[model samples]
Structure formats: structure tokens, C-alpha cells
Target: MKWVKIKKAEINEWNEKLKATHASFFQYPYYASGYTFFLFSKPLYIKLVNDQQQELGYSCILNVGAFPFKAGLIIRGPVFFKTNVDHRSSLIALKKFAVKERYTFLRVNANEPAIEELLNTDSEFEHKDYFPSYKGSQGIDLNIYYKPFDELLKSFRTDCRNKIRFANEKNYLFEKVKTSTDLEKVYDLFVGLGSKKKFSYRPLKSYTKIFKEGIKHELCSVYTASLDGRIICAAFIVKDSQSFTYFSGALELQNIPAKYSPANNLHYLIMQDCFYKEDRKIYNLSYSPRESGVYMFKTSFRPEEICKPGFYTYVINRKIAERIFSLQGKSISAIRTKLRSIIKLFNK
Candidate 1:
């Protein structure tokens, strides 16, 4: 019945070391959760916990600050999984914090999608059914999900499967990145791809720090696909106990190169190496751009469109903040769509 801000040092031991040392979403050391990616706007993160005794079913949240109009607050995730009644207690505690903090609405977009099983029966989330959804999830989920590699491959489009086989025949080297220096290559490839495709340069140092500190905390990781000792494709993965998301990626030399399109094959590699029959269960490909060939590429993999969750915003008045946030959300989505249109014009 009590909520307290866990000190940073203490928070590390719980989410970083303890969760990491024992169980994690991805087996690779890099996918840990608590590190700061962007240093400029530090997020106030929370771990919904039941540490009063033995705990179960709590979410870890990242408080991403208020939305413009000062009527909304955004949190990257409220990643909650229930293991016991404690989850309900934790959520109730968090609900109080949200209201007392005077945040008109809590905008939550899970880093990954909510599980169907949980939605069918999770009683922990008070506002689980309260918010209107913004979009459907367009990604592959691998948590508690496994099938024979042949079945998995058969599931992909012929072109995708063929690309993997072709890339393999070409003798491309796949290497896992382990150091800060390795990120320079990743950044370069990302920048090249972004420039060629007209997308903004992804914040590399923030990502690098995630990988570096993740290794320390066991949260962030990278994989590079190389040709003749030079990196051609690179991807960074994010993990928690329930999911592994390919967060950022790039390919240097392109024309939809077989070397990079074989990303599904790379995904297969991650399961074999990082997940390796662990409690970990989901692999998320992230949101499909939905307006371009990239979306076709994602859909060719056959990930089902699942209903995704959004953050809950409680308006002091039912209508005021809701309309404002709704408009803001639409405007933001429109801008992103426009940006993607511009980017796709140059995609190789």
C-alpha cells in the first residue's frame, strides 16, 4: 500500500543485476532495461514493485515528461507482468502516484505489445480498459513463442528466405558487438543509410551507451553482418523478460542487399544464441512504417497485427485533456507519416 522512489543505486541491483543475473528477456548481455539512452532529457523511471515481501507482477516504467498543452504526460512504457496479487497492489499504488502528481493523463505506449493472455485476464491494471487505442501493433512477438526453424522459415516470404540462404552462401560474417569502439562502424552505416534514405540520423551515442552500460547491467546488444571484413548491416536489440525488439538497424551498401534483408536469418540467430531455450519468449520487429516497401518487408515476415496498448490519461474533466491529447496525437502521427514519406523517396 506504499510507493516509494527507489534510489538509482538500489534500482540497479533490482532491475539490472538481480533480474539480469538470474533471468532476462534476451540471453545476450546487452538487453538490460534501466540504463539511460538519451542524457539530455533524463526520464524519471519507475519500477512497480512489491518489495514489501516477496514480489510478483510489477511493471517498470519510464516517465517521458509532459506532452505539449501541459495537459498530458507520456511514459515510454508501463511494462507490467503479473505473477501474483502484488501486481494489483503495485498498479493501484502507481495510480495514486499518477493522480497525486497532477498528470492529466498518462500516455503509455508499451515498448512492446501487451499479451493477449494478460488482456483477457489481468486485473492489475485499473485503467486497462479505459483508454482509446491509437494503433495496432505491427511486429513479431517471440515471447513464450517457439516453432521449428523450418516452420519459422517457411513462414517468411520466399524472397526473404532466399535472401538468408544467399547471404549465407556469400560467406558474410556475423559478429556480436561488445565495445564502444565497435559502435563507430554501426553509427557510420546507420548514418549512411539514413542520409541515402533521407531519415534523420538516429541518436548513436545514446544507443552506444545503452549497449555499453547494458553489458554492465546485461541489457543492450548489437550484431553486425559483414562482408569482406567490413560491416554491411548492423542491428541493436532491446530486451526485457518478455521481449526482444530490434530497436535500431542499418545497412551500408544496398539495393535491398541479400546481406541485410536476411535480417530474419539474423533474428533466427538471436534466438539460437541469445534466447536459447530460456524463459524469454518474444522477438519484436517493431512498428511497420506501414506506408512503404519497408512495411512490405516487415509484413512479408507474417507477424500478426495485434492490438497495442496506449497510456491512460485521467482528465480532471472527462472531455478536456482527452480532446487536446487526441489532437496532439494525431498531429504527431501526421508529422511522422510525412517524415517517412520523405524518407522513403530515397530508400535504396
Candidate 2:
């Protein structure tokens, strides 16, 4: 098979036909603008074809990284139009391209079934363990087998259902975010949430583009839960034609009343919007660690657990890549360990 790097128009043309939820927003041409503040991003499309020039599959690559740390991120890509493409061959071709381009590593979060199968089989690629991981996401099918809204509530755990009722009793109202002022409220809450949860937060400008560019283009939407004119929680939803991903959500845990569960209520409202308004087939809760608090909360809504081979890294230069990646892992682990000790000390 031959690999040909196609243009943005071609990528859009192909994506127009595919409209798969398994893909990443990062791979979308429009989504690139939101990410430019973090890394230099270029939308790339590599088409796989046979000797007869028959189209096999196409990969959407976001070529990104800082100076002296170049990497290619492939998110749910090498989307095949036909069923006959060789996953290994296409991957090897991608590796060759990365090496030729002098990238340090090529990281892939394979979403396609064939590619996931290949990654699971213990192929040549080396796995890179990164935080805020690129693992498979949990998603709820909005169509086909999904139960009706009332049935869905019944399926939730008793405590979860009760929490929703409590939120209702609190009389929280959900509204679509429309202005820059609303965006700042969400960002401030998100920052507060990040500090409380002890996780890294994206800069405000990163979110600004998502609001201005993504929402303006109708690729995303923001909804806020409020009580007495105070925003208690907010959720950002991103969509392709087939799915609505709950990309991010922020909660003001301190401000909400004892009986109210802002997260649950906000998500319930968001899911309703996904089902009724968006008419999307999948309501993606996005990725979270299994059995974690976030995971339990998401699963309480009864979304299906989507399992697949997550992120894998193919190091172009073994010696340099190993040292760099290993150091990164160790550094993060050290910081986490120190933070935990500090927290324990404070408790004492």
C-alpha cells in the first residue's frame, strides 16, 4: 500500500462521510485553533491506497509539539472506507513518516477496531504511559439499544437516582451559555475544581478558543446549572454528527446546597439535550480511570463501558526517546508522591 498525505479539504470530505464518534475532537481541523496555545498543530491527512490506487483508509494526524520535542498524535485514525486495509502495513507506514519527518515519537490512540486489534496483539510499538491519559473512553449509546428517558432513570443506582431527585427538589435551573461572561464563570469554576482535585488545569485562553471558535461554529455547546442567579455547575459538550461528548464539566462544590448535587443534575440536563436536541447516537462521558470517583459518577448514569487498546508510542530514536519519556514518567510520579505526603502531613 502507498501512503499519500492529502489536504485539509480531503480530510473534511472524508470526515463528512464517516462522522464517527470514536474519533477525537483534536483531529478536527476546526478544533486545531483551540490547541494552538499549547502546541504547534497542523492538520494532516494520510491516505492509504493499493497499487491500483484504490482507497483503503485515511489517517487524521495532529502534528504537534514544542521545540526539540516533536511528536505526532493520531487520534482514532486511519479511518478506513473499505474493510480490506492492512492495519499493520498502514501503521508501519506512519512510523516511517514520523521517522522521516524527524519526530521523536509517534503516539497513537487507536479507535478503529482493526487498529485496536493490532495494538492488542503486542506489535512493535512501545507503550508510553502519560498522565491525563489517552485511554479508551466510556460512552452511552443514545440510539439503537438505549432505553427511554424514564427507563434510563430507573436503571441508575438508587443513591444516584435519589441524588437527581434531591437536585430537582433544590430547583436548580439549567441554561445554555451564551455570552463571554458565562464562559468566565465556567472557567473560574473549572480552575477552582482543578485546585481542589489537585489536577492540572488548562489555561483560560485554551478554553477561550473552544468557546469562540468551537461554539461559534456550532461544534460545541456549554450549559450551566444555576440557583438564585449563581452558577453552581457547568458542562461543555463537543459533538460530531454521531456523538455528543461531555468534554469537560466544572462544579462549585462549596457553594451548592447540601441537598443539591450539581454534577449529577448538570449531566442529566446535558444528556437530555444530547438525546432530544442534538439527536446524537452516543452520549460520551469521555475518559476516566476505572473505579475512580469520576468513573463511578459517570457510570451511575448507566453509560456503556467502551474498552479498547488506548495510547501506544512508537519511538523513532530508541535511546533518546526512552530517556526522555522515562524521565517524564519518573518526574510525575515523584511529584505525586511528594504531594500525597504533604496531604498526609496536613491531616496529622
> Clashing pairs in model 2?
none
CA displacement after TM-score superposition, residue 205 of candidate 2 (Å): 2.1
Candidate no. 2 TM-score: 0.78
Candidate 2, 1-348: lDDT as tens digits: 777877655544554444543455545555545555543355566777889988777666666543235556776665666656677777777777777777767777776666777765656676653322222233222222245777767777677787888888876778888877779888888888888888865567767777776664467788888888877888887776666778788777575565577777777767777777767666777767777877777777777666655677777766655544554545444534543454466567
Error of 1 at 35 (Å): 8.5
lDDT of 1 by residue, 242-339 (tens): 55667778766555454445565666677555445544556666665579766666666666555454443434434635544454445444634543
Error of 2 at 266 (Å): 2.1
Model-by-model lDDT, in order? 0.53, 0.66
Off by over 4 Å in 2: 6-26, 39-45, 49-56, 64-68, 120-123, 127-145, 253-255, 287-292, 330-348
Runs of candidate 1 with Cα error greater than 4 angstroms are 16-40, 47-59, 65-92, 109-144, 255-264, 274-279, 316-348
lDDT of 2: 0.66
Q: Alpha-carbon error at 128 in model 1, in Å?
A: 12
